[model samples]
Each structure stands twice: as C-alpha cells, then as structure tokens.
Target: MNSVSTDLIIQSIYETLYMVSVSLLIGTLIGVPLGILLVITRANGIKPKRIFFTLLNGVINIVRSVPFIILLVAITPLTRLIAGQTYGSTAAIVPLVVYIAPFIARLVENSVLEVGPGIIELAKSLGASTFQTIRYFLMPEALGSLVLTMTTATIGLIGATAMAGTIGGGGIGSLAITYGYERFNTFVIILTVIILIIIVQIIQGIGNRLAKKLRHE
Candidate 1:
C-alpha cells in the first residue's frame, strides 16, 4: 500500500480506539453499579427483593436479546441527537455503549455471585453496612473478574465498531467494505483482518495478565 493508504489506516485505527474507549467508559460507569445493585438486592442477598430483581433481570435480558445491528439502526436518531451526526466513529459510540453495558452488568453480577456467602456474612457480622460490605468486600474480592470482564467487553466493542463501519463509520472494517469488498481489493481485506487479529490478541493478553495478578493478590 502507498504511504497515504497507510496513514489513513492508522487514523482509522485511532478513531476506532476513541469510539471504543468512550463507549466502554460510559457503559462501565452505568453497568458496574447496576450489577452491584442486582447482586445486593437478590432474594438471598443483603437487600433482598423479588420484584426489583425480576425487573432488573428482565431489563438486562431485553437489552441482551436485541442483536447489535438492529440496535445500531434503532439508535440512529438518538446517536444523531448526541453526536449531531450518525455516520462516523463518534456517532458509533452511542449504540456501542447501549449494546455492551448490560452484558457487562451480567458479567459483574456473575463475578460478584462467585464471592462466598460466608464472606458476606462475615462482613455483616463485623457490622458492615450494605455500602461498606460492597465497597470493602465484594468489589475488592471481585476485582480480578472485573478486569477480565472489562477486557472481554472491550473486545466485544471492537467488533461493534466494525459493524458501525458498514454505516459509514470509518475504520479498517469500513475501508475493507468500501475498497476491498466493493472493489474486490483482496489485499486491503487481508491486511484489515491481520490488524484486527493483532488488536484482539494484545487485548486478551493484557486482560489475562491483569486477571492473573489480581488472583495472586
């Protein structure tokens, strides 16, 4: 490829990263807390409630049930409202955040559930309030899983960004679609695949290392 093509590819990667980071950040801001709430309010948990758990579970299921492509199209209006346009990396974040947050929430809920009930009871026996228990015990104990889940979510968002590219959101995937598939440019398609594979490998490696460190702690 020419230098100009290389430059464009690099720029597209950076734009893709920006979209993924913003979406993941926003998703985590909302999802982690909701996960905690789901854990704490379950019937067997500290602040047990049947109705609330059912409602939260239903909401999560509904969000998860929607396919990402459909959600991407459905949120175009909201994306345009927030981004002032819905056909670029910046515009892609709106649906990406909405798509990943509930999955992250469920990951967190599962991780928190893995914590021993005895640990929770011990926190209570020490007179720890609900907030304290979660803050001191649940979160700390689940930090490793949290890191892994975030890693997984980040990778998922990368795929979402590729789909966003089909709607004119510029990325390697968009380049592949417009130049590779349409024009039958096999080289661009192959190169884009290589770049994506490298990105996924790096993310997974970092996540595994972090999770291992957290486990040792």
Candidate 2:
C-alpha cells in the first residue's frame, strides 16, 4: 500500500510540474511584454497612451476577475480546440494559461514599476532610446523582483491548476478531490497535501536563490 501510494504521489507531482511549466512558459511569453507595455504606456510612463492603456487595462482586469474553476469550465471549447479534448492535464493547460497570464502580467508590471523611475531617467539622460532604456536599464535592474514575481505567480498558478483537477484536469488536486475526498480516503488526502507542500517549498527555495543571484545591490 505504501509503495502504491508513493507511486501515485510521484505521478501526481509530475503532472503538477507539467501544468506549472506549460502555464509559466506561455504566460511569461505573453505576460512579460504585456507587462512592459502596461508600464511604458501608463500616464507617467515613458510612452504614455491613454486609450491604449485603458483598453489593455480593461482586458487584463476582465481576465483576472474570473474565477479559475469557472474559467476552466468556460474555456472548454478553447481547450478542446487547442488540446483536442476538454479533460486531463493537456486540456487544463489552456485555462491555466488563460488564468495565470493576466496575473503574471500584473505582477511583472508592478515589479518593473518598483524599479524606480530614476533608472529610466538616467538612461534617457545618457541618450538612450526607449528600447535601449527598457532593454538595458529597466529589465536588468528589475531582474530580482521579476524572479520573485515569477516564482510567486508560478506557485499560485499551481494551486489554481490543482483546482482544475476537480473539473477533470489530472494532478494531485484531482486525485485528492476525486479519489480522496469523494471516496473519503484519508490516506490519499494526506498524501496529496504532503506532495503539494513539498513541490511548493522546492519552487520557492529555487526562486529565492535565483532572485538573490540576480541582485546587484
């Protein structure tokens, strides 16, 4: 029984990792630039654009406002179009990306904003173009905060994805909800919690180390 439980734990952890990885990859690709745009086009930003900012901000808010579970069910057609099915880890990735992308975008925008306006001003004084400022000054200085943001976003998304399991997305959460909770299996419930905790700790530790490494001050 112990061996079997161990096997299940390993499998669930792997699925969780898969969901996290895919969501992070896709989210970062979309979110980072969206975040940069948010920062750059704000009222006091380097290239302020009132209408653009308002439109983009509204879109981000709309995405962020929807709950993950409902988002999961709501995007079933999209999930099916992308993954060819609306149940399992692959299908879950769609909603996971949809949910986490806006969150990550906001996180990254805030982190970049926190880098202080002086850095951008310095770059501009040095005859740097807007692109050059972002490429060299902003991104490099904000690296530490970005790492922390990504770490936090990744962990938060993992928890959200686990909830996706309750809707047929495969992971430790699905295992806990479907088999453990529904069947009233104490062993499975405890095991799922242990695995989720371990994974979160590992991710948090790595993120902290990376953030420290990126810090120049």
Candidate 3:
C-alpha cells in the first residue's frame, strides 16, 4: 500500500509541475507586458490614453473576477481547441493560463506602481523615451517586488493545479480525490497536504532569498 501511494504521489507531482510551469511561463509572457501597458497608459501615465486604459482594465477585471472552478468549466471549448482533449495536465494549462495571466497582470501592476513616481519624473527630465523610461526607470526599480509578486503567483498556480484535478487535470489534487476522498484513505490525504506544503515552502523560500538579493544589489 505504501509503495502504491508513493507511485501515485510521484506521478501527481510531475503533472502538477508540468501544469504550473507551462501555464506560468505562458501567463507571464502575456501578463508582464499587459501590466506594463496598464501602468504606461493609465491616467497620468507616461502615455495616458483614457479610452484604451479603461477598455483594457475592464477586460482584465472581468476575467479576474470569475472563480477559477467556473473559469475551468466555462473555457472548456478553448481547452479542447488548444489541448485537443479536456481532461489532462496539458488541457488544464489552457484555463490555468487564462486564470493566471490577469492575476499576474494585477500583481505586476501593483509592483510597478509601488516604484517611486520620482523615477518617472527623473526619466522625463533626462529626455528619456517612453520605452527607455519603462526599461530603465520603472522595471529595474520594481524588479525585486516583481520577484516576490511572481512567487505569490507561483504559489497560486500550485493550488490551482490541485484544483485543476477536479476535471481530471491529473495532479496531486486528483490523487487526493481519487484515493483519499473516494476510498477514505486518510494516509493519502495527509501525505498530499504535506507534499503541497513542502512545495509551497520551497518556492517561497527561494522567492524571498532572490527578492532580498535583488533588492540589496
């Protein structure tokens, strides 16, 4: 029984890592730029455009507001289209990306916002182009915060991957449900929780150390 449980745990861990890493990489590609755009085009921003900002902000808010489980069920068509099936770790990446992109955008937006406005002023005084302003003054200043923000996003993805198991997403959460819940296997449930906690702790520890180093340097 212990050997069987170990095998299930190992497979689930791989699936969870696959779903989270792939989805997060894709989400970051979309979200980070979107976040920079949100800051650059907002009211009093480097390139403020009221209509553009409002439209973009509204769209992000709409997506971000929906619960993940609903988002999972709601985007089944998209999942099938992208993954060619709707019941595995790969299929789960679609909704996970959709879910995390806006979330990462918001967190990134906040991180960039926390940068001192004086940096913007300094950039302007130096005749920096908008691109230069963001590249040099804004992003560098906010990078440490961005690291922490990404850490939070990564942790969120872990939980979401577990949740993704609900739809046969094939991760730790699926193991818990299939054996722990259905078969009343207390040991599996406890082990799954412990594994998740350890993963979270490692991610958080790395994030904190990196962020601190970034900030110090």
Candidate 4:
C-alpha cells in the first residue's frame, strides 16, 4: 500500500474512535438515568408508578426491537437536523446515540437489577432517602456489574460505527467496504479486522481490571 493508503487507514481509525466515544458519552448520560428510573418506578420499586413505568418500558422495547441498520435509515431526517447532514462521522453520531442510549438503558437496568433486595432493605434500615439509597447502596453494590455492562455497550458501539460507514460515515469500516470488499483488496479487510480485534481486546481487558478493582473495594 502507498503512504496515502496508510494515512487513510489511520484517519479512519480516528474517525471510528471519534464516533464511538462521543456517542457513548452522550448515550451514557441519557441511559443511566433512564435505567435508574426503570428500576425505581416498577411496581415494587422505591417510587412505583405503574403507568409511567409501563410507558417508558414500552418505548425502550420498541426501539430495541428495530434493527440498527433500519434505525439508521429511519432516523436520517432527524440526523440531518441534528448533525446538519445525513453522512459523515458527525452526522453518524445522531443515529448512533439514538441506538445506544436505549440499549445502554436496558443494559444498565439489568445490571442495576442484579443488586439484591437485601441491599435495599439494608439501605432502608439505615434510613437512607430514595436518592441516598440509590446513590449509596444500589449504585455502590452494582458498580462492578455496571462496569461490565458499559464494556459490552462500548464493544457494541464499535460494531455500529463500522456499519455507519456503509452510509458514508467514514471509518475503518468504510475503508474495508470500499477498498477491501468492493475492489477485492484483501489487505484492507484483514487489517481492519485485526485492528478491531485489538481494540475489543483492550476494552475488555480494561473492563475486567476495573470490575475487579471495584469488587475488591
């Protein structure tokens, strides 16, 4: 490959990172609160509201049911409105954030649910307020599991970033699709795959270590 190709690959990598990280940050901000509400609004939750819980839960489910690619196309107009266009890394983030926010909400709901009922009782016994109970007891107890869930979310974001490339989102995935598959350039495909593997490994390893540390604490 020429120096130009090498530079393109590096730039693609940066674009992928930019999309994934920005979406993850924004998604996490939206998702974590929704997850907390899902837990705290159920029938048995601290502040049960049957109608609200049911409605919120349904919306999350409906979004999750749609496939990511379809969601990408379906939200193109909104993407254009938010990102000011329907293509490229910045525009890609609108759909990516939309896709991952509810996904992270579900993951967070499951992770937070894994905290035992006993912990809730303990918090009550200590006279912790609703916010205090969640902040001090549930969150602390589920911290380790939440870390793992976020790790899974991160990896999922990476895959979605590649898919975003199909629509001119521009990343290693686009490079592979344009040069590797379309032009039958085996090297780009292999290189992209290897780079993705290395990225996933690094994320998983960090998650494991962080979870272990939280567990020890």
Taking all chains together, each candidate's TM-score versus the true structure is 0.94, 0.95, 0.96, 0.96
Q: What's every prediction's RMSD, in angstroms?
A: 1.7, 1.6, 1.3, 1.4
- Estimate, for each residue in 1-217, the C-alpha lDDT of model 1 and write its tens digit: 7222878889878877887889999999989998998998898889998899999999999989999989999988999999899887778888889898998999999999999989998998999999899999999999999899999999988888888886777776677677777788788888888888999899999999999999996
| Best model per lDDT | 3
What is the lDDT for 26 in model 3?
Answer: 99
Model 2 RMSD in angstroms: 1.6
Worst 10 residues of 3 by lDDT: 1-10
**Candidate 1 residue runs with Cα over 4 Å from true position:** 2-4
lDDT of 3 by residue, 125-189 (tens): 99999999999899999999999999999999998887798788889877877778778889888
Q: Candidate 3: where are CA atoms >4 Å away? A: 2-4
Give the per-residue lDDT of model 2 (tens digit) for 169-212: 67888878877888888887888888788888999999999999
* Clash totals for all candidate models: 0, 0, 0, 0
Cα lDDT, all candidates: 0.88, 0.88, 0.92, 0.91
Report clash pairs, candidate 2: none
- In candidate 1, which residue pairs clash? none
Please give the lDDT score at residue 131 for candidate 1: 89
10 residues in a row with least lDDT, candidate 2: 1-10
Candidates in descending TM-score order: 3, 4, 2, 1
At residue 163, what lDDT does model 3 achieve? 78
lDDT of 4 by residue, 1-217 (tens): 8222778989998999999999999999999999999999999998899999999999999999998899999999999888889978999999999999999999999999999999999988999999999999989988999999999999999999878986678887777788788777787788888988999999999999999999995
Global CA lDDT of candidate 4, please? 0.91
